[model samples]
Target chain A: MDLTVTGLSVRLGKRAVLHDISATLRPGRVTAILGANGSGKTTLVRALAGLAPGEVRLGSARVDTLDPRERARTIGYLPQDGAVHWDVTVESLVELGRMPHRAPFAGLSAEDHIAISHALAATDTEELAGRLVAELSGGERARVLLARVLAGRPAWLLADEPLASLDPAHQLGLLDRLRALAGEGMGVVIVLHDLIQAARAADDVLLLREGRVVAFAPVAEALSPDNLRAAFGVEVMQVRDEAGRILPVPIGTNR
Target chain B: MKRSTLILGLTALVALLFLGSLMAGKAWVPPSAWFTADPRWWIVAELRLPRAILGLGVGAALGLTGAVLQGFLRNPLADPSVVGVSSCAALGAVGAIVLLSASTPLIIFGSAMLAAAGGMALLAGLAWRSRSAVAFILAGTVLASLAGALTAFVISIAPNPYATAEIIDWIMGSLTDRSFSEVQFAMPFIAMGCVALLFTGRALDALTLGEDAARSLGIRLRRTQMLIVVGAGLAVGASVAVTGVVGFVGLIVPHLLRPLTGARPSALLLPSALGGAALVLAADSLVRLGPGATEIRLGVAMALIGTPFFFALLLRMRRSAWI
Candidate 1:
């Protein structure tokens, strides 16, 4: 089922953050939301996840009208700052994702155990499963947080700046995991600051400028020189790598 | 230690302390007194039993509230008193004594409960819109200060010296001379409050990931906040209304049991409740067994113990860079 947004507007306090945004995000595809700072990337993603006020529909059902538990089971969202307050173990942390699936007083079912193990393996956090989250390094913590989201096995995954603290290898590893999830008919949306990673990993790209969509298209068109210059005010020198993939490296500011 | 084992140990300790509390008064009534029809059975039944029950209920309420508040605010220093409900209830009880000149338990209990409900309502009104833990804490601090100042104002203008002494003695807090009526009056509120707090464990566990993630995980922020406020208000209000203001059981028990429970808020709830009961029962029993002619106030004893523990905690937290 496709996630659709129409005439969506958001205001944080008195300032308008997102204005009349409309988009259709399909299942089994990775959509990379690329934008400069303060371009409403987080806001847009949060709105889509029903964390912010917006008119959103999942297939034929209004996403806002869905039960909170059902919405949580369908849409898994990871915020920009992945702050874990307690010093709980990695496995315990991941088990928190299954909260929406389990009853309040009931213990974990066998299905929950399977999903937890799968998430741990996928994020390569199996080794850190027994370790406390407070003791993990920055990159390790980021992976564990991502694993927590994956444990829920939501139909749609929305992550904001998930790659911020990750190393290059882990970033690629995460992109691969996201692709694998998309292959399994799950809709994956990520907010990214790295244009090259977005272009390389994303099936569709949504570019934003000052809370407005500059372009929403396939990678080739969305990251085109003109659109990149318009959205980010940066002129990129397109270089093709050994695999013949276009990598856009910003040369100078268009401003 | 395993969570189950720790809980079992704490529960056993609470049971033991309860038995000890019944026997540790000025007149030591042996366990044989119950079966042998000793004349001192009235002391066991009429005097000590009610006090022990209150100690257990009050301690459990404080401990449970402390764990819930700390988890909800994500601040380890949060306790039943931090939210201002206890102080507001104290003010209500003091007002009943000074203004109405009523020393009756029913009037005092009703006034304190009403004030605590008001405090909870005011807290909700002030912090509801921000929906931030920091905002809630700030609002609580403000209300606490306001209630404290008002309580002082009421005391300064007391109608007589006897009333002032009575007010001072009551504020010192004790479980002494408490009858079964006080126990019956407080148990229902304490039990209800605990039930409400127990339901908050899952939501509190979700909150370990912070507000946005907690909400995304299907935890309703408003509902969780309401539970914490109302639960703590009812429990702490009734406790203060009955026994004046017993301090530190809520704060100390949760902090002590957090490591044993593996630091999960949900896992800490029951252990904290049990631990709190044990700590309070032991303290209450010790105060009764003290050498002084006048027994040490339960509140005073807790402060005497809690201040040093609190200092040690702060020093340790500083060394660990946890502050």
Candidate 2:
């Protein structure tokens, strides 16, 4: 099912962060919301995930109107900070994703176990399952946090800046994982600051400027020099890599 | 250790300590006296049995609330006593004793519970705007000090010296000479509070990922907050009304058991409850066997034990730079 947002506006303490935003996010595709700071990328994604107040629909049903558990079952969201208060083990942390599916007082079922194993395997975190999250490195923690979201098996996964603080290799690995998830018929939406990474990994790009959409199109068209300049006020030099993929590298401010 | 083994061990420990509490008073009641009609049986049936039962219920209530509050607030220092709920309940109990001349247990129990609920309400209201841990702790400290001052004021203006003495002794907290009536009065509230707290384990588990992610996982924040407030209020209120303020069981038990439970807030709940029961029973029994001319009050004994542990915890936290 496609996730749709229409006429969505969000105000955080009298300051409007997302204004009249509308987009249709499809299943089995990765949509990267790209913008500079304060462009409302997080707010837009939060609204789509039903964490913020807005009109969002999954297929035809209003997402905000759906039961919280049902909404949770369909949409998995990861915040930017990804705060873990307790020093629980990685396996236990991943098991938390199964909360929306399990009945109260019921132990993990066969389905939950399978999902957890799949998430661990997909994220290459099977060996780290027994280790405490507090002891994990930044890159490992990012993967484990993503695995937690994946364990829920939600149709749509919304992650805000999941690549922040990750090394280059880990960033590429995460993008590959997200692409693989999309290939397996899961809708993946992520907020990204790296234009090259977004262009390489995302099927489509939604560029925003000052809480308004500058362009929502396929990566090639959406990340054009004009759009990049308009959205981020940056002059980007598009360079083709060995795989013949266009990579936009920001050169300087668009003077 | 395995979760099952830990739970079983804690349960066994609680059972052993419970039996020990009944047997190891100032006058020892041998196991043979339990079956045969020995005059010492009265000590077991009438006096020690009720004390032991109250110890179990009150201990479990405090421990479970401590774990729940710690999880809910995402603060390790959070407990009924630390967050001023116990002090507010104590204030209410003191008011009832002063105003009603300690006429009825029901009046005192109800007043304490109501005051605890009010304290929780005020705490929530004060800290609602800020999600920061410091704000929550500051609000709790202010409420606790306010309640403490009111309680002292109530004591100062007591109608007579006898009432003042009784108030002071009760405030020291003891399980001595308690009968089945006190158990009947407090047990139901404790049980209800425990049941409510147990239901929050899954939510607390979800909350380990923080508020936004927990909400995305379908944990109802408001409902969980309500359960914590009501649960702590009733549990701590009834405990104070019956045995006065039994300090530190809530704070100490959870911290001691967290390592064994792998620091998962949800996993720590039951073990903390059992550990709390064992700790209180052991402490109460130790006081009974003390060399003092009179038995040390349970609250005073717990403070004596807990203060050093708390200091060590703070020092460790400081060394680790957690603060």
TM-score attained by model 2: 0.95
- Model 1 lDDT tens row, B197-231: 99999999999999989989998888888888889
List chain B TM-scores, each candidate: 0.98, 0.93
User: Which pairs of residues collide in model 2?
Assistant: none
Q: How well is candidate 1 docked (DockQ)?
A: 0.75
Q: Native-contact recovery for every candidate?
A: 0.67, 0.68
* i-RMSD per candidate, Å: 1.1, 1.4
Error of 1 at A113 (Å): 0.3
lDDT of 1 by residue, A1-255 (tens): 899989888899899988788889999999999999999999999888888878999988888678889999999999998988888999999999999999998999999999999999999999999999888999999999999999999999999999998999999999999999999999999999999999889989999988888999988789999999999999999999787878898999968
Q: Which pairs clash in the backbone of model 1?
A: none
Q: Write the per-residue lDDT of candidate 2 for residues A1-255, one digit (tens) a residue.
A: 999888888899989888888889999999999988999998898888887778999999888778889999999999999888888899999998998999997899999999999999988889999998878998889889999999999999999999987889888988999999999999999999999999899999999998998999998899999999999999989999888889999999965
Candidate 2 CAPRI grade: medium
Off by over 4 Å in 1: none
